[model samples]
Target: MVKLIGDLIKDVIEPGFCLGCNACVAACPMQCIKKEENEIPVLKTGCINCGICYGQCPQVVDPKTLQKAIFGDNPTDELLGTYTQALAVEAKDAIMKAHGQDGGAVTALLSSLLDDGYIDGAVVVGTGEAPWQPVARVATTTGELIECAGSKYTRTPLFIGLRDAVNLYYRKRVAIVGTPCNIVASWRMQFSEPTNRHLGETIRLRVGLFCGGVFRYKEFLKDIIERQLRAPLAEVAKFDMKDGRFVIYLRHKPKRELALSAVKRYIDLPCKICSDFTAEFADISVGSAGSPHGRSTVLIRTPTGAEAFDVAKKFRKFSAVELEKVKPGIEGVRLEAKAKKGAAAKELEIMRRQKKPLPVWLQERPPEPPKETIESLKSISRV
Candidate 1:
């Protein structure tokens, strides 16, 4: 049963453990893992066996909920305080603010690292006339970094920078900021290529954002058009994860509004299979929802992340608040996530327990990524 999580972690680090959560299907390097009824995780058995899922699972998957698991009862160190939206401020009160959600704490953190010469560059996302464009960018300055703000909840591949970082790793280090899936991909790449001496050694930091959820690129956009506004899915240029709600402003004759409930119903087949809400492989993971403005909520997962952030704090880039205690409400979200996954997994084990006929939903593949970008929609975010 993999009773000990440490055992699971070790097995996963080497040969691997499934924990029965099916994130592997969506993020598979080989496009494996299929969904059965209700969209649960099912190892295709035909899987090419790429290990993306092993590294991405919440570093600790308690299976009970989607909430972050605090294994130790250690006092909550106020690495940074919680914020809503009011606390935001600029970088130098810098140029990045123009691009970020609010004042741009994220930009500030990345910019600080760059300005101090700590990192040679920042791996970030920027928008293009299409979805693929927002997937990658190597930001080296405040202006270049901020241009890629707003919530981009689609799945992106961070390994896109793997080659570039390796090429430039000699003189400077690189810090990567991304969602859970992207972070795990990069982390694995580093372990595999660590001694590259140039790129692997140069990639120094991983910053993960607390994830509310990630949707399939096409399905998410489709929901906004069909269910919510009953309008054309004009374009979804910019998005944000704020206040426990996924806020996406749509563009229609007048503008259109979409709610999370309708979107949740349409989550992609891949998301339904895997269940890590926080990017567990990152060095430091950030989240909003309960975190207010001006203040950023940070989870210091690695000693390196803690040290790097401490260095930034010394520069007065921003101030931080230490939670006397983490609110149960905040933890509740994760718990719910974990529970949802558990119920689904138990069902998988039950039906498959017999090695008999298991529920199955198969599809003929060979589909291309959607050519869905409408040039006209790009204007919505700019205006």
Candidate 2:
């Protein structure tokens, strides 16, 4: 059966595979989609079945097929995806590093991109009305970038920022930094023929953050933060999941933490279904997952990503160390990635027995692409 945008609501959304990334909402030309307080997208009224929303959705197409479309037939590592280089990096700017969740490489890279005119602005998630509440914003200057530097453990519908950055703000070239699911959405939107060409043009760069999982803010904040941690939301100076604990740094109190496994019960269903640990589809992926306290593991996955790194290096934004020389080396990342994939595969099987459709990412890997599709991919290659 041919799939349409409406099909996404039943096949993926209702089944709990939707990442709430807002890619579908941005793709809808009718402006019929809206996300409520619960963080799920709902179609308002007009039902054209135009398919752009589904085409732009990451959950609809197989990740393996998308990878082939982007990376050609050259085999990629099972864990790291296709990459030109891997390194441990840290921002040279001390202030950025201080504000950063880890190494500040993402903010430093965006700073260089803006200064070099590679991008007009960047889409970032920052503290919102409530502490740790993620608000998507366009960072047009270094100060704005710095304000959006750190991580928010909660899932933010980050791709919605693209709509504002392009339609409302009228930015010509934009960079976006987001988690693994967001990267999947961006890469699909960038290449999907049904997506608005102008909207696709504004996306100049994709920076992905490695993610373990995202906690539901209402649950994690009210229950865990206020009730268990005995701290108010406004007092949180910094919050992150490190090692095996959920660490919270308050402005006036001693550091507090809880077992990471204890908090897993608060993770949303979509995150539980997600398998991309290192953002396998992103041009460049950065995370503290397998790095020392002061460094970030940077995976340069495409030629464009490598070029961006070279430019950032020329500007002396950050320094890179050999991946093998780092504390939690490439092997650490590989093991985690494999474990996540295995867990997802097992969950997919259980869902299958329950008469639910498996998400695109969990489908069997695709074989070689047809000659025509390979040619099509080459023509569409932006990097």
Give residue 20's error in model 2 in angstroms.
1.3
- Per residue, candidate 1 scores C-alpha lDDT tens digits across 1-383 of 11222332343422222222233333444545554432234555454334544433433333222112111122232212112112222344645544566446677887778777777788776655654233556777777877776566665544444444444433367887876655544433333211122333456787777665565555555445545556443454446655435555554344444466556655543344444454555667666533445344566665566666767765676555542233433454345446445644564465467553322221122122122321211121111
Compose the digit string of candidate 2's lDDT tens values, residues 157-214: 8877888899888999888898887877886676665665666667777888888788
Worst 10 residues of 2 by lDDT: 360-369
Candidate 1: worst-modelled 10 consecutive residues by lDDT:
374-383
Off by over 4 Å in 2: 353-357, 360-381
Best by lDDT: 2
- Candidate with the greatest TM-score versus the true structure: 2
User: Candidate 2 at residue 210, lDDT?
Assistant: 85
After superposition, which runs of candidate 1 have C-alpha atoms over 4 Å from their true positions? Answer: 1-98, 131-133, 168-172, 192-199, 222-237, 242-244, 250-257, 293-295, 324-383
Give the alpha-carbon lDDT of every model. 0.48, 0.80
RMSD in order of candidates: 12.8, 2.5
At residue 103, what lDDT does model 2 achieve?
Answer: 92
